[model samples]
Target: MQRANAELVRSLGAVRVIDYTKEDFSASGHTYDVIVDTVGTAPFKRSRGSLGRGGRLLLVLATLWQMLLAPWESAVSGKKVVAGPASERVEDLRFLAKLAQEGSLKPVIDRRYTLEQIAEAHRYVETGRKRGSVVVMVSHG
Candidate 1:
């Protein structure tokens, strides 16, 4: 984890944050209830071994092939591989807003850009090294 992002994640009550630059988390022989793949570099096939029983692998940046195979893999295994476009629901948004208001949920912003820099933000996100969310500021002026 990047030093800047690590502080945010820690503040959010993450028990531990592995630094991928210095260590391989998968090779540590530890299993987790939830594994979120943000970079899309983790191996889906081998990830099954990393999940505990009834665990979930949330693929935020899955490839097309990974997305296609997720359902089939879930059907045959106890673990679940979740990947796809997300649907926005009012209830979920409300809950998130509540959390944010309570200071329990703070989004980690890796970079910020104005509306005019949207293309540049897209390119940065595409690089897959962004530690957290990219903010695109919309000026009312």
Candidate 2:
């Protein structure tokens, strides 16, 4: 909601924001170009709703077994719901670095924890509703 209020929501380039907590995103009937799904806690089946007619969904953290049991609807239909590992090539890293260097990049760190405060870091991250990445500061001794 902060992102929406800030008017900087477009920074992520996502046309519409889906708050999975408040509502079921599948009911929106909104077709997404690329749905990068990192969270997979659903069992009621909702792959089709997130994808367009020929859209693609990139599953980031699905297990090998889950990938093997890929959604039947997505395969039968033209829409592709990719499962399993996402290989990060050298080019991807380069692109990330380039983007980070650009003024368009900004790291949203809700909390910064020192290496010695690992427990505190875990606690902060367990809140499960962070806008962006949480930083764990590593001291170079």
Candidate 3:
């Protein structure tokens, strides 16, 4: 996590936000029961030490090799690694939508682009500088 987005992340219910640029959370000697990595910056090998006994690491995005090695690693070690594509259930989507509607959840939109500017939007996203979700508007007109 970047220092700039730390506050925003904390406001979103994160108990603690570690700026990877300043410190390495894995080397801090602290352990967690569950660690969800949306990006592949923290892999199983590097994160194993940070996990407590029977801790679970959820990898939202992982390589094929990592996915294949997950089960073996979990079996060998007491910690578990879960790597796979997320399952989108309609009920879950509806629940999230309800939360957003009730102001219980707030989404951060970093940028918005019209359908015609989609190419430019892709370029910006590829740069990996966007802090939040990029919206592409489809105009019928």
Ranking 1 against 2 by lDDT, winner: 1
User: What range of 10 consecutive residues in model 1 has the weakest lDDT sum?
Assistant: 38-47
TM-score of model number 2: 0.74
Could you give candidate 1's per-residue lDDT for residues 13-123 as a string of tens digits? 778787888877788898888888876867567788888999899998888988899999888888899998888999999999999999887787889999999999999
Please provide, for model 3 over 42-119, each residue's C-alpha lDDT reduced to its tens digit, 9 standing for 90 to 100. Answer: 999989999999999999888999899999999999899999876899999999999999999888999999999999
Please write out the lDDT profile of model 2 over residues 73-104, one tens digit for every residue: 46677777678766899999898889899956
Best TM-score among the predictions, by candidate number: 3
Ranking by lDDT: 3, 1, 2
**RMSD (Å) per prediction:** 2.3, 3.2, 2.0
Judged by TM-score relative to the true structure, which candidate is superior, 2 or 3? 3
For each candidate, what is the lDDT? 0.85, 0.69, 0.90
lDDT of model 3 at position 39: 73
Tell me how far the alpha carbon of residue 1 in candidate 1 is from the true structure, in angstroms, after superposition. 4.6
After aligning candidate 2 to the native by TM-score, how far in Å is the CA of 140 from where it should be? 1.2
For candidate 2, the lDDT comes to 0.69
